[model samples]
Target: MEQLHNKNTHGVVRFITCGSVDDGKSTLIGRLLYDTKAVLTDQIQALTKTKHARVTASDAAIDLALLTDGLEAEREQGITIDVAYRYFSTVKRKFIVADAPGHEQYTRNMVTGASQADVAILLVDATRLDTSKSNISLLAQTKRHAAIVKMLGLKHIAVAVNKIDLLNFDEEVFKKIKEEILNLANTLKLPTPQVFPVSALLGDNIVNPSKNFNWYQGPTLLAWLEGLDISSEKSGVNLRFPVQYVARQDGSAAEDFRGYLGRVESGEIHQGQQVTILPAGSVATVAEIYISNGLNSFGQNTSVEMAKAGDVIALTFSEDVDVSRGDMIIAQDNSSDLLTKQLIADICWLDHDALSTSRKYILRHTTNTVFTKVKNIIQILDIETLSQAVEADSLGVNMIGRVELALQKPIAADLFDESLATGSFVLIDEATNHTVAAGMIREAL
Candidate 1:
């Protein structure tokens, strides 16, 4: 059995499988895991012993979809209900795969998965699409998922034409689906999607090339994913550190030992660097930086001198500044201005209850939480046509729209296009504490 934590030469590629219902997102993930030799012997035995009820006793093939659909409700309904995450590694690269639900009602779950992914593998079931017509239309849920992927700014996209074995490996069908997917990508202004013909159930064109599709000559799905270059794009981003905790010396040993503890969301931080504390407009010099290194004999975190992006560190300032848990520490030379109390944003409504402008909601951005309300709904998006309509007043479940927000206090936030860490936020219902919506800051008003 191949261990999930095996070292790879390249950085981990985080991706999500998403599309319309019955697109074989879970099965595709299972196939990738199985073919990569990531499944343990005991796990494979368990899967073989408890095959799907639909499979006959004579059938020797294991139900691969059972590996990911762990929820009993999901197994009974034969559909994915929540986001399922799995890890596997090859000699060249490591992978973190997310199996996102395809149902329209569970769109929020998909959004949660896509938020952290660098690539998206959208599965299109060939049997579900009508290739006989001149103008083959994709499913409504497929279009919706693509639009959401574009909105979230995913750069790499791939369309896997799944279940091609059912269509007798027809070249014309694959070409038609590929053309329609290209058109959809153009309409949504997404990056040109790389299309491939695959049969997730039969283990064709997944980890290895399939001999059934003689006309097609493209790299296997795993090959393309392993060779993707996403590191350059992640580099050179500006620093956006949201203070999560304020650490101070308990006794008088150090006397004035005060440090701001948080993860460096982007860019890098060094000792003696000048930083600006947001919302308060206080300028301070970094006296010392301490990167967290596990725990010592006393169970206290050991420290180092410098830290970079993705590192959690404690930074002490030269001056005694009024820094709190919600305050943000940014580079003094940062180009964008990120302090504002009013904002215009694009939001996805996730709650069952409709958004009410009169009701007060809690807005949590980075580490800051403030009371907020919907001042006005700018427009509602029509997923099918990709048009914005201004006639709508309230947003319903799984609906994406633009809205203006009025915050009770000013916050440090960059536009979503500028910095994902500082721009994204969630709206929580004050009464029930349920997350009602996810918002991306478009502009500060």
Candidate 2:
């Protein structure tokens, strides 16, 4: 067994915030940061003493919601516009939070944030049960987001039914919302999601237990996040690494060393296992593993014959091999039938211009980038209703579509539902080198 580290180490957790603009995603994040004392003292002072926080005494309550609703339009509309990212740390964990927009128009931004997320916090407005984008029917928005998120491959979620004070602290209302949310989640085949009845305005069910809803009993949002599994193994994936850099002999004890440096993208990587290099197709055993090398990469030389998933280590192969950045390292047994030139993909269209068969973009999968043209818009995914439209001619901005892509060269990737780390890719505008869309591998098409 590997040596256990100290308890005080900060385990990292990245997550996205969901729900409509009114579900208090921004306010909930602010409340979580505030109650945990994660926000700086200067910011906290501004919260209490600043006259700018309020236009009048009626607004003098120091709207914690104002603290994170960063966009001017967001402040005016009282909703999140763009994806607002915030970072903070508690005693047990360090967090990178993406408070994504709740509007249907901003679904692309939400997808960008969802790409790296391990947990999703779905905020539900308790007062208005429906899920509309901007009004009292917020549950409509909640259900829509739930479906999109599950389609986007997020399973672990925390449904924070916030703004409960306006519901008279009634346990029945809370129970009703929780049950509805769970039912929707179950419909999407999402895992058993944790639901927390919270009041971001009053800091209830955020940091500590709430006195407002005395009959309700559950862990607070913070406690749930704290207990969330940050283990790299949770994704249920096999070991794979995309080689980032290759290190060779230097001075001192490193003179005879050769290492393939990269962070493990999924599963476990162990020394002495036969590993294969992609593109060039070379195979060798990991002679040694390294960390703390002269270079500022993740791993160096070591005797770790077996390292679990998510470890970043430098692996020394037995012989000089043609491995470089943009090449993937795979366990010999894990290698399967890799696609060469044709693939069927589900693309989340992020480009302002509509996509058609004639458009050519760079398809980047794992460490390789290849030129490609979309063969067809097979179907557009209706995330809100969970249906597919078979006859769509074009995919507009923020639309999720299943399209046939023909690549200029072969790339290594798996089916999206099979392995998210290696299965997802992005299409870049060859001219501008800007990412135009995100795609998931469905199969060769």
Candidate 3:
């Protein structure tokens, strides 16, 4: 139940970029990092040195995509192959950009990267917009990309129509592509995503305004990113702080000292507040909220008495509670519902072996892991069409399905839409020790 309720805080926004195979996603990421001065001198030199064999038919003095597409094969083929992470921050906010590869087979990487991101940028090549003859396969792939991003819970999406210079900066093409994507977004029931026409290669509308697109009026990508905030603004929600560990001064040093360690997952947790530990249903009042760097009883220096929403703090309890890892603390006031039972969720399959209907795996939710079996694959959404179909017996790689997981014992988790911390789980194949699927909590926890 740990929640990120504050929308105004200077938070780290993780984003994933998805697009057609030739939409310049890697190039766009490189340009964003370069324009922001996030690239260092040594890394820049490394990029220049690799230019000997990294040339494509469309080559530049510096192959910017080399800044992100790190694989040797990818460099030789002039394509992105793996999901690359590029971290940077600006004057206003911090960012973690997951540059996902665009090929159809790499869809699992996109899902993995998408799992941790707050927003998504879908880049499109304006010249190759929805062509029935040339881009038939690409159009189908783009539809799946949008559907998967929505399923992964990206609150805000930005469509950057890249390579406008190739189209002579055509305004009509921009409008037509924008309208087409808008229609598709509406069909997916996703939040109305904003669109920006840009040339990531030419540095137009990326860091600053573009001189070539005089008719384009949308906010520049940088300005838009700076202005945007996390959409999960559910403040005043029920408190959910799951305990990760217990630290104590045992036997001798300071026998009276005891603390429960965990991050603040949800609503505000103040010192000396009443709380109930889940599963055990033990009630206690917080005696002191101890942080990693706690100060003594001096009212001179600055020390936060209370953590707002996202801050992590350790707490000492009034009562001698036997709380351990995987336990949850609920604020006493809002104890309406607590669950420990069967659950359903949307799953992103990752294993090359199909998810057999009768198979069992170790399900990890937060710090708790339990043996679970695939009860059913209730709704299998056609990735290309973005619509649900009849029940399938097995799920393949990169295929997303709404599954009902039957646990050997009841587990404590929240509906993903209700609380992301409690609502997410991963499935590990017991025999091979490989993570086969990533799932989010669904209705009726």
Cα-based lDDT for every prediction: 0.85, 0.74, 0.77
Superposed model 3: Cα runs more than 4 Å off: 1-6, 9-11, 52-59, 71-74, 127-138, 234-236, 252-256, 293-305
Candidate 2: C-alpha RMSD to true structure equals 4.7
Query: Across residues 1-445, which tens digit of lDDT does each residue of candidate 2 receive?
Result: 0111122334677788988767778878887777777777787777676544532334225667666777777777777778888888888888888989988778777888887787799988877675332322234556667766776677568888887777778787777777777667766688888988888778888889988878877788888888775543335446678887777777786477767777677667766789877766778888877654445654442466666545667788877788877788877886766546788877778778778678789888776788899877888867556568898889887777788888887777767776776778899988888778888787853
- What 10-residue stretch in candidate 3 is worst by lDDT? 294-303
lDDT by residue for model 1 over 69-117, one digit each (tens)? 8898888888999999999999998899999999999999999998888
**Clash pairs of candidate 3?**
2-265, 2-266, 3-265, 3-266
* TM-score (C-alpha) between model 1 and the true structure: 0.93
Winning candidate number (TM-score): 1
Q: CA lDDT of 224 in candidate 3?
A: 82
Question: TM-score of each candidate?
Answer: 0.93, 0.82, 0.88
The true-structure Cα RMSD of candidate 1 reads 3.6
Give candidate 2's TM-score.
0.82
Give the TM-score (vs. native) of candidate 3.
0.88
Pairs in clash, predicted candidate 1: none
